[model samples]
Target: MIELLVIPANQSQRRPNWLRVKLPVGKEYASVRGLVDTHKLHTICESGNCPNMGECWGAGTATFMILGNICTRSCSFCAVSTGRPLAVDLDEPNRVANSIKLMSVKHAVITSVDRDDLKDGGSIIWAETIRAVRRESPATTMETLIPDFRGIWDNLYRVCEERPEMISHNIETVRRLTKQVRVQAKYDRSMEALHRISEFGLRTKSGIMLGLGETEPDVIETMQDLANTGVHVLTIGQYLQPSKNHHPVMDWIHPDQFAKYKEIGQQMGFKYVESGPLVRSSYHAEKHLFDQVV
Candidate 1:
């Protein structure tokens, strides 16, 4: 058996103050829960163990996970379950769209796990989901964070066909660490995915995680590469190991470093950069649609 190596248990693994997350609560939060439960929709908030689930749910926004909770890829950095995913639920698109309508969300975020088992990489569903949301909630702007589609342009074209306000494909980490961190995903392919999205004149976005033993220059170089691809927005966040079985946190990055990365990203000509210990791909994503940053 090929045994996986994990970081040793140490005091450094203890989360710092900057990483503290608020517990889910409040009336709006409960209402959102009702929508999620009643409609039987899956969300990245739960699957990805997002830190801002409380804050975002309290504000009546969420990143909906489509296809299924299970992923096709077994990336070391992701917490989403891997193995054989259940058959695709064809009705999920309208369910998610109607849920967004019921919530009266102003800006919606949608994402899906890699479904390489499917012929289209689940891109057809991705496109239909966007169309459903647009039809159900005409006033709601949207951001669609997507998989690499294993670099299939035809499948990618189906997604871009909807012309969502923004399209995000996370590089997840620096180039040198891509093999270990993102496993099945390639650094250049992800960049190319963003480049293709940019070609459509849609607002292109991508995010990278730190604390994976990546160097400062690696980040800067990644930013430069993303800029060259015409990516307009960027997000940087500290990587927290999902569990002992997953990838280990290499080092605890300071808040100041995140701040510096934000500055560096802005200097690189990105329209906006969300960098902080608690930031995630869709953190404060609603604001991204308005060209506003919090």
Candidate 2:
């Protein structure tokens, strides 16, 4: 067993000092909270138990979760609920768009649960949500962190047609752990999805979580895989186990190692790499809107 995993389990379930985050506070966070509640909108920040919810919501940026909260696939590392989702809410796109409008979000990040139950894999709603956001807030840039649509290229094409400022699909773990971590998601399909997205000429991005027992070589190979797909941006974050029921954290990667990975990703030709203990898929996401490293 890896030292970080065995040590933490043996010592009791306490996170390292660096992982501590300020409790969600501030007027801006309160305002964003009210708007989400008012619009009955779902955000990955809340659903996925994102550690940076406080910081992101405080800054008035949110990654909206569309379709519904219930996901079809039960990825072991995720906190989102799994089951048959609610009937597709036709009006959800408008509500999300209106909420972004109310918040005056300059760059909106939209995501959804995997609705594999739907024939089109929820791509219709995906495209519609992008259109609605574009129409409601023309100036607001968008980053859609999307599902793989079960490798149905047509569904993927539907989303690309909208051409959000950036489109991201997370290959949540390395290929070796994909079967264990992501249950129903296939590593090859995800790479193909990103490759197809890159072929569309849109700014492409993807994220992966560390600490699932992935080796440095696994991480580097994953980075190379993503880069081969023309992924313009990459996000690397520590994988904090969502609950005791979820997959146990295999290792708590040190910040220095995270920094080293970021440097390696830069050398691998990624336009940008966000790697840190507390980083999540959409953490500081707005900065990835351009191809240039900021």
Candidate 3:
């Protein structure tokens, strides 16, 4: 089979059919939105400009982002705002836990902005939020999408103390483009972080966005590196530039390629591989939690 890539003629890119998502409607979606707004909670669903927000929200699942809405790092490929974050909200843990209680979510996914401005890199908040959620909703499982914390093992240990079902720290991009794509994040440092998470016997998960000027071999090599770190789950998706200011989308990968990569990941020893044009880190997160096919 011959493969084809859709290279946009200009910067004003048109999305392919595979990338389109329906507008959010339905009572479940409305209820979740209301709960988030009422409780003053931040979710990656809204902050990351996730394409699956409508579908995920409509299904009553969303990735809660604690700490604050503003991120400190200026990653070229991200849509989240980059600026000074507000003072740490000490009460945020309770609010997130309470919101999860109200949502009655079976599996909750939480993420946060890079709080490098803090001394402990906000890992304390990350740990406290996990504790609060467990206290309020004992039955709800969770996965935390965390930052690198500049590879501070002491700070990363804080999150490990809680030992949520799964701990994820995204590599975001291939090693070659790490500096350009992540601004200040280091690829090897992230690999070490994943290794440490695995060292604690926790399920380690990470994700990488495609079309960031990466070659097929770059992705496969990155996958091998992640596998070496004992990451059990991996998410691969097409990179959609949030604005003209962000990194431009080089090509729209075909769905067939995504399926191929999923196969590659599984063979590479990942238990669950979520790969597609629309797949996000938290996409079908609950499924990623329990689907362990040996």
Candidate 4:
């Protein structure tokens, strides 16, 4: 088993001031919340308990989660539920598209839970969701934070055929901690997935979280590896432990460190880098559509 740098439970509970988030309270936030609830839609903002939920939702943008809220993989760092998901809701695509249309979202981000139980890894729903969104909201641009499809290239290509503006598959953690942090995922497989997405002619993106006991060298190496895969956009963020049963916080990475990583990522040839303590996969996603930095 891999050794972990376990912070004392009591100390891990106290987060630094930089990690604080404003409460989700505003007209836009409420409006977006209502749309999601009414459409029976799922969002990574709510499912992952993202720290930037308030800021993102208040700005009238959200990263919609399709397929279903229940995920098949139980990554130690995620707050999303893992189990036998309910049957694939075929109407999900239409509902997601309609919700996007109602929100008048100029640029939208869509992601989904892993559906390993499905033979095609849920890529069928993935493609349908993109098509539905494009049909219902003709003017909206999109970035899809997709799953690896368990290395099933045909399934991955199915979604790529729809050609969302950008395709993202998060590395989530460094190679060293892949097994512990993301139990069923492989670092090399994720890299290859990103490479394939880039080769498909769409802009590619990936993200990773710090404070999971990853060393600086591990992070820089990971960035270079991503750049080698033709990834144009990268996001770096601090990892906040989701619950007592989840991975413990190894350290509270300082803002300066995140800023430093951003600089390094930019210098390494990533066209855009959104790096900060509160950064998540889809945080400030619209900016990435045109390769803009945050």
Candidate 5:
């Protein structure tokens, strides 16, 4: 049997400053939650248990997770469910578009669970969702955090034809720890996905999680690799184990370390960098890229 590596229980615990969060009780937060519930939409905030859910919801923005809640690949660090996914919700695209319109979201982020069971890995639905959002809110900028489509170039081509404002596929971790951290994903394959998306002239982006037993050199190397793919935006966040059954965190990288990573990422030619303890791939994503374009 493969021996499970163990780390300290508190390895992922944040300091007092890092534990700050506002409760989801305000009027704006409740209103946003109501809209999601009314449309039967799934936001990454609730599904992925993101730390910034309350804040993002209160701000009337959210990251929508489409396809289905059940992911085919079981990444140890993620909180999303892993199982045979349900059939594609045919009405999901319209619902998501309606929700975005209701929320008056100026910039929207859509992501999905890995649906390997599907022939095109749910790329058709991704394209439909993007188009739906565009049709409903013509001025809203759309961003998609997509799966690699398992290296199916045709599937990716279909999604790219929608012309999203940005396309992101996360590397998730450094090359050395990729197998242990992202068991079902390939480092090279992820790089290829980023490269392929960039080739289409879209704003390509990718992300990686730190504190998963990766060294500083490894982090830099990963950034260099992503930059080499012609990716325009990069996000770096500290990995926090979602449960005891999940992988243990290797370290709780300080906020200053994340700031330094941002500096290095900018110097490496990333058009936008969102690196910090609380940073997720879609966290404040629109603000970062929008600020640059404006």
Candidate 6:
């Protein structure tokens, strides 16, 4: 088991009311968990240890992680395993569709670990998953948080053609910190990926993490860069180091700071902004995106 390093609260620290969360239990939560297990589906909630897992799962929603759990790139802040990963499960799309059906999910968020070893960068699988979900649960809105595809425009083009309700590709962090935090990803490449997706006239979205030693200016600049690419949605979450071996949190950003970032993101033209300490890329994602589209 990987040990996590948590920052101790300062002397003046007073627990913020917003940090309080309901414990995971109840029929709804168990039902969702059962469906995932029954279908052999993986969720970022459990795999990446997202703080919002209880709330989201209790609400009968989850961010499905397709392709496989093991990631090709080893980002220091991520809890997903780093390895070559298993071969693509060809029946995964149908299983995801079945799980969504069982949960009666009105909206679904599909994400994946980077599969650089795949010839199409797993684009074909992404398209197939979207199609499967659509076919099984037609009313469900779809969102995909995808990899950068190593700057391969053609691969991205194929995924965008599926016409998901929203397409998110996180920049993850500021340009300077990208190297230290996201070792294998390139800042410029991620920005370009967002740009390319937007160019296809898709509803593009991206996210960034705070408390990773990034300056305010760096965040603002990164947001501006995202806006320039015509991204419609933005998420800002506090970086909680998953394990002791992961990167250390530089600072604990207060809830007020997150609110300010939300304001900035909106003022900069993001149609929707989910910004807060507990916000993950797919946190409250269904409702947030639904509010924007409907």
In candidate 2, residue 70 scores what lDDT? 91
TM-score of every model? 0.91, 0.92, 0.92, 0.91, 0.90, 0.89
Ranked by TM-score, the better of candidates 1 and 6 is: 1
TM-score of candidate 6 versus the correct structure, residues matched by position: 0.89
List candidate 6 segments past 4 Å from native.
1-20, 25-27, 34-41, 290-294
Residue by residue across 1-294, what tens digits does model 4's lDDT show? Answer: 433333433575688777788788888788888877887766667867777887777765678888888899999998889999999999989988987888777778998999999999999999999999989988888998899989999999999999999899999999999999999999999999999988888889999998888888888899999999999999998888878899988878777888888999989999899998899888888778884422
Q: Which ten residues in a row have the lowest lDDT in candidate 5?
A: 1-10
Off by over 4 Å in 5: 1-16, 24-30, 37-40, 290-294
Q: Give Cα-based local distance difference scores for all models.
A: 0.85, 0.87, 0.86, 0.87, 0.83, 0.84
Model 4: colliding residue pairs: none
Residues 135-171 of candidate 6: C-alpha lDDT, one tens digit per residue: 9999988889999999888899889999998899999
Give me the overall lDDT of model 2.
0.87
Residues 86-141, model 5: lDDT tens digits: 88999999989998898877778899989999999899999899989989999888
Name the better of 3 and 6 by TM-score: 3
The C-alpha stretches of model 3 lying farther than 4 A from their native spots are: 1-12, 25-27, 37-41, 291-294
Which has the better TM-score: candidate 1, or candidate 2?
2
For model 1, give the RMSD to the true fold: 4.8
Q: Provide the clashing-pair count of each candidate structure.
A: 0, 0, 0, 0, 0, 0
> What is the Å distance of residue 292 in model 2 from its true position?
6.6
- Score residue 81 of candidate 5 by CA lDDT: 89
Candidate 1 has a TM-score of 0.91
Question: So what's the TM-score on candidate 5?
Answer: 0.90
Q: What digit string (tens of lDDT, one per residue) describes model 2 on residues 120-209? A: 999999999999998999998899989999998999999999988899999989999999999999999999999999988888999999
With a 3 Å backbone cut-off (N, CA, C), the pairs that clash in candidate 2 are: none
